[model samples]
Structures are given as structure tokens and as C-alpha cells.
Target: MTSPGSIRRIRRIDLRRSALTGGPVDYRRAVPRAEFDVEAAVDIVKPITDAVRERGVEAILEFNARFDGVEQTEIRVPVEVLHRALEKLAPEIRAALEESIARLRATCQAELETDAVTELGPGARVTHRKVPVGRVGLYVPGGLAPLVSSVVMNVVPAQVAGVESIALASPPQKEFGGLPHPSILAACALLGVEEVYAVGGAQAIAMFAYGVEASATTEGCERVDLVTGPGNIYVVTAKRVLKGQVGIDSEAGPTEIAILADDTADAAYVAADLISQAEHDPLAAAVLVTSSERLADEVEAELDKQVSVTKHAERIGISLSGSQSGIVLVDDVEQGIDVVNAYAAEHLEIHTQNPDVAASRIRNAGAIFVGPHAPVSLGDYCAGSNHVLPTGGCACHSSGLSVRAFTKSVHVVDYSREGLAAVRDHVVTLAEAEDLPGHGAAVSVRFSEPSPVESGETTP
Candidate 1:
């Protein structure tokens, strides 16, 4: 850990000074973001995906040996192993995971949408139905942390959405005899998922996209309809490369948090929240945008004091001092809202006198925690909300993983002869205008007289 007094201070950006100059500020450009390039990694990831496509399990074993530093002949984990892991799980930890699962399941149940039928007129009806994906591959990071909670986050929604088949993958640990972390396996067991693999990194994603052929020693792994979860840059790049072959939730980048606080916010609470996210990785972003300069100064001091004693001080220090993480000074709470909206952080926390009012104005965010009492860490585990959210300003266009992500919307149209006749003229006119007479002919032929064959006459 870094020395208490030597911890680096978080940098500051003074947007208030820019506002005073009476010049327009491009908030998006002014905001700090991590330098993430998924496209540049295509050359490195494409070969691995191709190899998995051709060689199947052979290529997966090679990549696992090279990246995960574990040697195993078979990738699929046995059902007995999953049971053993759950059997050995500590009582307290098991209780905590069970509670988290129940809470998330409840939320997912409430989010389920029912089919809706609409009648345009007599004999014309349309129905919108929600269909769940058949199968899904959920990846859990086992690098810095096991992230056992991720199993619950990904599985509960997929299960709640009525997905039938679920497969999970995590890196193999040499210390655990070439198996994934025991906690991860236990969580899978608890969720009633029988298909688990001890694979990791970009190769695991390829295994899901192309699938592995059955070998003499290993059973075949079938391809999944969709893949969801969070992982490192390499895993994210693989998802980007093999997107069309298999569906992906999003190209998730590094974790990030943006706190919109004011003079009423407690400095200690603000400082601790920033450090919590920074502990995830050196690339994680922890930003503070506040109107009160006094609050900003206090947050900085609190960060310096708290980071020095934390177990991951060295890692947190690097993230806090990096270009992606900083403190931005705004003119007032209103300006602070604009800065945060433009930032579109993965997690946005509102800390003001009226957090509800501030939260209502927010137009873009993966998830909003309204008040100092509700922290990002709560959502990560047992807050009944998903932690698999979009990063790198993706919240502006996308959303966090939920029951809806695992389902597809299909429109069912029903029409009678009368319904067809009602719109026949309009269809003919529009089709002719667009030079697509075939579309109109299909409708017109339905109403026209039957052909000789349809009338039971044989052609000569």
C-alpha cells in the first residue's frame, strides 16, 4: 500500500471559471473519460475467435493455458463440483447470497410485461408479445475479484424472462485445482444452473459464440443466443468482434461513478463512495461534480485521509489520480445537473437538499441513487437492481441489464377478407407510388377470382 502521506491528490477542473467568461462550454468534451479503444484490439481478438470456430475445444484449452495459467483437459465443469461448492459454502455467505437473489428476483418479476392486443377495426387485430431468448451465456470476472454477485444479477433476469437454457463461464484458478472460484460455482448451484465452464477471458466469449464440438474426453458446448455480463478489455473486445454471430448486451467499458452533490452533502459519505468504485480497477473512474467549493475541498481532504489506510490504497490512488477521475467545480446545483447529464455516468448519485427533485430532472443514467444513504455498492449486491450497466457514456443511448434485455418484442398481425379490402386501394396507390407493384398485386390477387387450378380444372 502507498504511504498515508504520499497518496496522490485527485485533480480538479474548474468549470465555474469557464462559465463566468460568458462562453458556451461543450460539457461532453470538457468531461474527462477513460481512453478505451475496442476497435484497435480487433487484430488481436479476431484470430482467437476464428481459432475457436475451427479447432473447437483444442483452441480453448490453449488460450486458457496461456492467459489463465491453468492447464485442464476438459472445460465443462461437472454437476457434482457445483453441488460440492454449495455444500461447503459458509452459512453467513450463503444467507447473504440467498437474500440478494430473492430481492433481485422480486424486482425482475415486477418488470415482466404482458402481451397487448389492439383492434384497429372490425376483423383487424394486432398483438405485441414478449418472447424470451432460448439460451444465454453469462460471464463472471474472476481476475481481481470473483464477483459472485454477478451470477445473481445475470441469471435472475434471464430466468425471470423465461430463458430456458443458461450457461456460465469464469476463469480457472490454479490454486483451486483448475476450477473456477468456489463462490461462483456455489452461486450457480443456488440458481439451479447446471452448465458451468472453467474458461476465461476473450476465449470464453468465443466458446459461447462459435460453440465447441464434442471431443472424446469432453461433451460439446452448444452456442447461445445471447451473451451478457462484465469483464476486462479483452473480453469486451471479443464481444465486439463476434457480435453478429452471437448477440451481445453491450460493449461494456470500465466501471464509472459520477456524484452530483452540493453543500448539504456530507464530505465523508462522498469521499467513501468515490473510493468504493475506484477499488474495482486502475481504469475505473470516480468523479465528483459539486457546486460548493468548500464541499469540494472537504471531499478531497477526506479522500486523501481514507485512501491512505484502505487495503487497496495503491490501486485506488492510481484511479483517483488518473485523468479519468477528478473533481469538477460548478457554479451551482443547476449547473451541476447539466454537467452530470452530459457525463452520463454508469452510476449517478444525487446528494442535495431535495434529491428527489434533482433525480427527476436527470434524463440520462444507467442507474440513479437518490440520496447519501443509497450508495452504489448497495446496487452491486442486494438493492434489487442490476449492476451490469453501460459504461463510457453509453447510458445516454442504452440501459442496464434487466428482464427486458433477455426478451424480444414480436408483433402479430391478424386480418380478414374485409380488413384486406378496406386497405386495398391505399396499398395499391402507395405501392405504385414507390414502384413496388408486387406488394399491391399480392393483396389484389387475394380478393380476385380463383385460378383454373384452384377451381378444380386441370391445365393442358
Candidate 2:
């Protein structure tokens, strides 16, 4: 085994030998904690948010200069510039983006829902209508990678949900002359998003939550009703603090992938999939919970060979060797499944001989990939499954970004005179039982030509 500090070292947990209390070891306790503390980050971003609230766009520009190091004269990118970015995009990349957009659009359209009308009686009905949010702000991180696919991921669902007004904001790139990366802009153009902004981090989220007051340099954005998309700690913290002000997708943590494999699984395929996720960030977790010691050793060796030649080798190395990433040796395939379920990874891959059976048993995961061919990278780009999934065990309770995330369900109740009469006594009875005489009175008063007890009194 290599030393912990070595890039080649990945923590190995032999659960069979450990003194874990329960039948299944709590995998989460063994995993490395993220450097980002959202609560602590709240303290750091509170002042920035307060400043933005006080000064508006002037504060955004100040934060942009202080944090992003790019001084943008104008926040919103011109529509013409968005179009030009598409025209100049490389043909191969553009073709790929177009295919991704088409695939995602088709999937989103299929997921589109219709209003349901439930008729309780002849004259009364409750219609559950799916309403698209009026306006939204989408964030795209312009960090390590360009993440052009994110533009498609965030924009397509909102479009499918019929969101009329959409605004996208990414960190201003110094290389792009104080604008978001051309690829990011090109994606906006491809999706027909006219409103784009050159901003990023906490400031951008702040800008979206409380729209900047219109000024000489910019027309300013309308405060969005909802905000979706992923970013770093500061971005997540911004979303957390501004939750009530605007709707947010989820408080996403570091990216994670958990592979539940057996002796029959391919070692090379497992290693490649693990490496793909590790490239995202140093905190990105690539966990393998497996029954076969032989397969684990093979994967460890394969990772060494593959990571050495990858483009982002340094980043990938740090991620794999970090406490967050490792291999957990379980007693058997069933135990592996138990371990993964407890971990509730963002992405779970089943590479067993009975992949379908294994995948079907999974209770917690943002998305499940079956067999060897369905890699996490495929889902990230063209799987048609939204890539903005919950991370850091959030898959246990939360869902990924989707058309449903962009829509709000509203119940429309309609009651005729007879229908009101039918439920009036029941309403009055329940309201009175709850000790609210006024509520019962409100219902009884409507049909108060004269109650049986009040027949002697003059009707008002």
C-alpha cells in the first residue's frame, strides 16, 4: 500500500475486518469530509449579500472586481455577441452540443406533464395545473472546465416547462475579455436565450435574488422567481441564504460516484468511470464498494496507469487520493449493495452480471447507471438525464434538476351553488370543532336566509 500523501494512494477499508457496530458499516463516517462548510460559508457571504442588497449593481461590480478579478463594464452580454459565439464555435463541438440539446429536449418533452382534473361530485372539481415559473436565473460555473453542457442542462428544462423569461449568469473570464466563456455564450445562443450576464459566484446569485436597480451602464435584471444550476461553495451558500427570496434547485455539495461491483465486473471500466468523476474537483468522491478483493486490486492498478496519462492528472490524482475517495471491501455483493445504499451516492453504477437486478434494488441515488457501457460522463453530456443531480448523500431526499423542478403545481378549486351547499354543513362542523367560530360563521352566513335555529330572527 502507498502512503496517504502519495497521489497513487487511495484509502482501502476492509469492512470484513472492521469493528463496525451494525450489520452494515456506516460508509459516510469513513468518507472524507468536504473542505467547504456551508454554515461557515454563510458567515462569509452574509456581508457580501448585504452589500449587494444595499448598493445593487454597483455592489455586484465591486464584488466582481474584488473576487473574480475581471472588471466588466456591462453585466449583461449583448444578444449579438451571443449569436457571434455560436457562429465561431468549432463545428465538431457545436455538432455535439446540438445533439445534446436535441436529446435533452426530447427527454424533457416526454417528461412534460398535463393538468389533472379530479371531480369529487357533479358540480365540484379540483384541477391540479402544472404552471411554469414566470422567470428564472440559471448559473453556470466557469471554473476548471468550461462546463458548456451545463448551459444545456439548465436551459432545456426551463424551456420545456415554458418558463417565459430566463437569464443565465457565469463568471466573467479574463481570457474571454471580461465576458463568460464563448462556449457558454454559444450554448445560450443555441438555446435561444437572449438574456445572458457576465457575472459569477455569490455576487451573481445575489444579483438574481434582488435585481439590480437600473443604471446608466445596464438595463438591470428583473428579480427572478426561481434560480437553478450548480456552483462552488460560495454559490451554494448564496442559494442557501437567498432560498426564500427565490426558488433554488438544491444545496449541491461536491460531486460523487459510487460503483457497486462484483467479481464479474470489469476492472478497467470501473477505474475509468471513477477517474472521470475525480476530474471535477479535489473533493469529488469516487467510491467503490465491492465484494471482490481481486477486482479492487485490478482497479487500483488500472487507476494508476490511466490517471498518469489523463489531461487533468494532477486534479484527478488529488481527488482519488483524498479522504473523500476510496474503496470499501464488503463481505459479499449483497453487502456491497447495503454499503452503497447507506452512502446514497449521487451516481451509482451497477456492473454486476445481473446489472438490472442490482440496479432495481437501489433505493437511494440521484441516478443509476447499469452495465459497463453507461458511464457517468455519458449522463453528464448526452444521456438526456439531467446532470445537475444531488450530491453528498442528498440523493437520499432530493432529486436532480428537471422539467418538474421548473414548474409549480397549483390546485384550482371550482364550486357551484349546489356544490357549496353540499359541503357547507361539513365545513361549518369542522371549523366549529377546531374552535374557530368565525370560520364556521363565514360558511353558515352565506346560506343564512335563516338557519333552522335563527328562523325567528329577521334576516340581515
Candidate 3:
């Protein structure tokens, strides 16, 4: 239920001329935080993570029943059900998922890369090998939206990375016999991955990383090396707590997007982008830092018009009304860029005419979309780049999941006698300088014994 006043803030297109002034959005008061209790949620998740880590499969099952309302002793989702799921799906959804997968594949191919090798010295050479993790765990959020698009977003990149195994975990629906939505199961089958689990939350993450129950075992069953995708705060916390025991992608938080537009920008386009991100969850932050008061006014009006028609009208209303979402008028485009940089958003769209230049000036963002044509939604689905990204201001220091997220490098040594001799003095000098006599002794051992040729020289 969006209040009349809340709806009034949206500047409709009929009132478009109000945005031309190019004013400033108050940085201090742009968005509010009524229900985004990230700190509290993180605190609560620590216990859940520890419980799952200590109790393993049983704890996960308990959380599944408690949170998702589906109880199961084991976590496996059978193949028969998965096959039937596609048939049960509406044709429109089936077609959409198929198209999205194809589009995403093309995008991933462009972003994925292979490793390289180089030689530093005559005998010292190094090579980088792009090896995928033996196993990866993907947690898809289900409490709110079905997140069928997320199925493609996560698995495609891991598949592109050549990860040997991908284990998917989604909450079980009672209406579906604790099975994931048929669309999701169909997606798993479509991707050619067979290991699926009907589980969710912090517990599901634990089962994947720590290996719970006699349930998920295979012929060569083992714990996963890396876990990815998005979930609620509890899931994010579990990943944080268990990071040392297993690898984790960025710890995501409430979704957020920052749009930078100029006076020439379409108010409708700007408003739609902001509202789309807002609909993800009530806590998602949608911001437009623009140089046009008239544009802001019109976008606010456009938001009022389009928001009424959104499918998730309740969520859309809550998100739009939430303090975390609003239009900010900046002094100019340069100040807008600085505000965006300071925020370090997960998704950023530059809609100004010189979008490339604006994008170039951006210092921090998980993903950047340039021009009106490349909206954040494209990246969320069919854009070849990965969608799982660092969030909650973390883009300042981290990055999104990609092919490189699954690999690690270790130095290999292949020193020959000559190679060892070539660096003996340097090693000895450094070792002696560091007061490590044993290090020098180790290098000196090769020269400790005299060569037989010395005897011939003495006889001569």
C-alpha cells in the first residue's frame, strides 16, 4: 500500500520540465534505512552458521523445516521430479529461461579467459594454469522471488570456468514435495548438472561446504572447494564464518543500484531502472544521482505511473517508499560521479550522452552499464558478464565472481645443479644478512666436496 504522498514524489513525464535545473541531491538525506538491519542480521547468522558447521546435515534439515517449511531427512532432489518440472512450467517461462541461458552463454564466452605463462630468467620460468575447482556449491534465494534467472546467472559462469561439479541448493516447496520450482529444476537439467539439493539458508551453505549427512554422497563424494551465488543475510554470514574452511565469493547484502543521468536522459528510463532494482527486496537501494531537477521531478512522476503496474506491487511500493530509495539532484555530472564512487554500488548505469567517459571516471563498482541501451537488467540476465557481485559497499575492495574465482596458483620449483649454483651466493648473502646460517649452509653443501678434476690440475 503506497501512501498517496509517497506516490506523489514520483515525477511523471507530464511534468518532465521540472528536472532541467540540474540541482544537487542531498548526499546526507538521499536514502533512508528503516528495515535494512544488516548488522543485526549478520549477528544472528553467526550462530546459524556455527550450528550448521557443527551439526552438519541434521542442522541444515532443521533450518529448512523452520525457515522454508519443508522437512526432509536427506537433501537430494530426485531426477524424476526434475524432469517433470519442465513439463509443469508455463511455456512462456520455459521459453524465457531458454533464451536467457543462450544470451548468458554468449556473454560468458566474451568474459571468460585462459591462463598464460612467462619466463623471468634463463632457468627461472613460471606458468599460470587456469584450473577449475573440483566442486562448487551454489545457493539460490527462494524466500521472496523464485529467482529462476539467478539459476542461469550462477551456474553458467561456473560451467564456463570448467568447474568439474556444481551442486545447487534451493528451498523445498511443500506444494512441490520439497522440490525446487520446476523451472529451477529444469534449469539444472538444462545446464547438464544433475546434483541438486532441496535445501536453503545458512544450513544449505554448510551442507555444501562441510559435507553433511549420508544423504548427498556420491561415488567420489567430497566437500566443495568454493561456494557462490546470493541468499539472505544468514546465508551470507554462514559463508563469512566458514570462509577459512572453504572458499566463498563475495558476501553479498541487500541489493543496490546507482544510476547517473543528465538533463537529456529519459525520465521514464531512469525511473524504471531505479524501480526495477527496488523490487528485488524491500531493502534494496535504488538511487538516481542526476543533474536535472526537471528530470528528477519527471522520473518521480514516471515512477508513480510504472510502479502501480509492477507484478510485485507490494514489494515495489515498500522499496520505493523505503528511505533507501529516492532521486538525488547533484550539482553536475562530475559531482554525480564522485557520489557514485563514494557509494561504490553493486550495479551502476551511466545514462548521460558521454556515458563512456562517465564510466571511465568511475573508480569502484561491481558492474558498470553504459548508455541507455545497456541497463543493469541486461547484466542481471543475458549480458555475457557474471551477475554475482560484491555488494554493501564492498565493491570498493572486491569484485564479482568469474572464471578466476575458482582457481588458485602455487609456485613450482625445478632447480637444476647449475641453476642452484647460479643463485648460491645471492641466497647465501641474503641468508647471512638475515642471521639464518642454516640457509647458507644448505646452499654451501654442493661446494663442500672438491671436484675430481682438481686432482688432475694439481698433477699438471
TM-score for each of the candidates:
0.96, 0.95, 0.87
lDDT of 2 at 134: 96
Top of the candidates by TM-score: 1
Tens-digit lDDT track of model 2 for 1-460: 2322355678888876454666744666765445568998999898888888889888888888888788877899999999999999999999999999999999999999999999988689999999999999999999888889999999999999999999999999888888999999999998999999998999889999988887788768889999999899999999999998889999888899999999999999999999999999988999998888999999998988888888888888899888888888888878777778778888999999899998999998999999999999999999988999998788889999999999999999998666888999899899989999899898787686856544565547
| lDDT scores in order | 0.92, 0.89, 0.77
- What's the candidate order when arranged by decreasing lDDT? 1, 2, 3
Model 1 residue pairs with clashes: none
lDDT of 3 by residue, 262-368 (tens): 99898888878887888899788887888888887788778777887888766777777666766666668987887788778889999997999999998889999
Which rank order by TM-score, best down to worst? 1, 2, 3
Number of clashing pairs, model 1?
A: 0
Looking at candidate 1, the ten consecutive residues that score lowest on lDDT are 1-10
Error of 3 at 392 (Å): 1.1
Q: On residues 1-460, what C-alpha lDDT tens digit does candidate 1 reach at each position?
A: 1334465678899899655566788887787888789989888999999999999999988998998888888999999999999999999999999999999999999999999999988878999999999999999999988999999999999999999999999999989989999999999999999999999988999999988998887777899999999999889999999999999999898899999999999999999999999999989999999999999989988887888889988889988888999999998889999999999999999999999999999988999999989999999999999999999999999999999999999999998777877888999999999999999999999768865655777878
